[model samples]
Target: MRSLIRQGADVNAGDVGGFTPLHDAAREGHTEIVKLLLDAGADPNAVATEAGDQTPLLDAIGSGSIETVKVLLARGADVRGNDDAGWLPIHEAASRGTPEMVVALLEAGADVNARDAGNETPLHHAVARGTSQAGSVQIVRLLLDAGAELNAVDYQNRTPLHAAVATIDPSAELMRLLLQAGANPEAVDRHGHTVQDLARMNDNKMAPAMLTRALATARRDTGRSR
Candidate 1:
């Protein structure tokens, strides 16, 4: 690789897919190659056509290479750069439930509440793609603690709580977390369906029951506080 560079190889050359050497190195977790490519003046923010305009940093996050991500960030890669789909690196991290990547991106000033093309936040992805109930719960907690909007709505006017309850594998506990974080149980979607309505529509028995109880508790608390 060094010899090729010494011979004046175009470090930023892309194939038909628009994948630069840096994108390949970052996606493959080749830390040394990534450094060499960046040192050779490869554009760190180069987007791959086949990957929906994903940058090297986004690829590194997708590959779950923390060290490679560090390398890209050190080279001044755009942490907030999004793909053509409007999915940011933070959104990918959240979708994969990689807390380490999430923390790293956040530390580098990634917006926890950034919306995708669909207007869905990282919290929405975290809940929608979470592999398990406990995993989703942890990721949700992380986002909320980092100041994610508890009631942020997507293009469909569905909040994270709404998305959570409507997921193929719904978790009552996840809904509980959102409610506790001040998510509005009464909030409706574009179709006028509330969180409970979504849960029932999705055949999620536990979530609706949990949301109802939480809503009752929240109402009582509000009444008392007033």
Candidate 2:
């Protein structure tokens, strides 16, 4: 790669899918190759001409390497840049990257409340993606602490709580965490399903869902709006 760069290779050349060498290196977490390409005048914020419009920073987050993320940020990667899916780097980190990655982006001044094409915030992605998995809860907390609107609605008019109760995580901890954070229990989605209604509908015939039981206890304990 260095030889090609030294030989005057067009470092920013894109492939058929509009993936440049910088995009490939960032996606692969090739920190040194990334630096080489950037030094050769690669556009850090260059969007793929394809439908996704992925920038190198977005690909670096997919690589899940904080070092690579840092390198791109230092090279002028824009945290606000969204993909074809309207997801920012912060949205990707909140949905799947490590907590450290989210923290780094936040420290770099990424917007906690930035909206996507669907108007979903990083908070929405943090709650909606995956199954309230191991790091997911922490990501949720980070967004909340950063002042993510607890009830920020998406294009579907669904809040993070709406997603938490509707998803099939089964742990119920995500819902509990949101409720404790002051999410409105009565918030409704575009389909008009309330958080409790979504929880009940999500219950299988085998037995009631853990989320239902957790919500019941929350209501009983706090006498919250039913």
Candidate 3:
């Protein structure tokens, strides 16, 4: 690769799809190659046209390449850079449930509540893409601890709790966690669907009951606080 650069190869040359050498290296998790490309003067923040205008940092996070992410960050990549889809590296990290990556991005100044084009935060992606209820619960706890807004609404006006209840197999524990983190069970979506409405629509038997109990508890807590 160094030989090619010395031979007058354009380090920033893009394919027909606009993916530069850095995008390839970063997407494939080639940490060393990424360094070489950066040293060759590859644009660290170059957006790939075929890949939804995603920066190399977004690609590295999508591929779960933490080492490559570090390399990009060290070379002055944009930590807050988003793809054409409006996904930040932190959103990808949270969606993948990689706590270490989440911590790394957070330390590098990734916004915990940075909304995507759809107005969804990393917490929203974390819950929506969670492979298991337990894993989703853990990610939620991590984001909440990092000051994620429990009541952040998406484009549809759905909170994380709304997303949780709409899951194929909604966990009462997940719902409880959001409520405890100050999510409003009474919040409605664009179609005028509340968390309980989503629970019923998704046929999540446990969620409606749980949401009801949570709402009652929240009301009681408010009353007591007053």
On TM-score, the leading prediction is 2
Query: Residue pairs in steric clash, candidate 2?
Result: none
Candidate 2: RMSD over Cα atoms?
2.9
Total residue pair clashes for candidate 3: 0
RMSD of each: 2.9, 2.9, 3.1
lDDT of 3: 0.81
Q: Can you list the residue pairs that collide in candidate 1?
A: none
Best by lDDT: 1
Candidate 2: misplaced stretches above 4 Å? 130-132, 203-208, 216-226
Per-candidate TM equals 0.87, 0.89, 0.85
Cα lDDT listed for each candidate: 0.83, 0.82, 0.81
- Write down the worst ten-residue block by lDDT for model 2: 203-212
Off by over 4 Å in 1: 131-135, 203-226
**Whole-model lDDT, model 2:** 0.82
**34-91 in candidate 2: lDDT tens per residue?**
9989999999998897849999998998888889999899878998998998899998
- Stronger candidate by TM-score (2 vs 3): 2
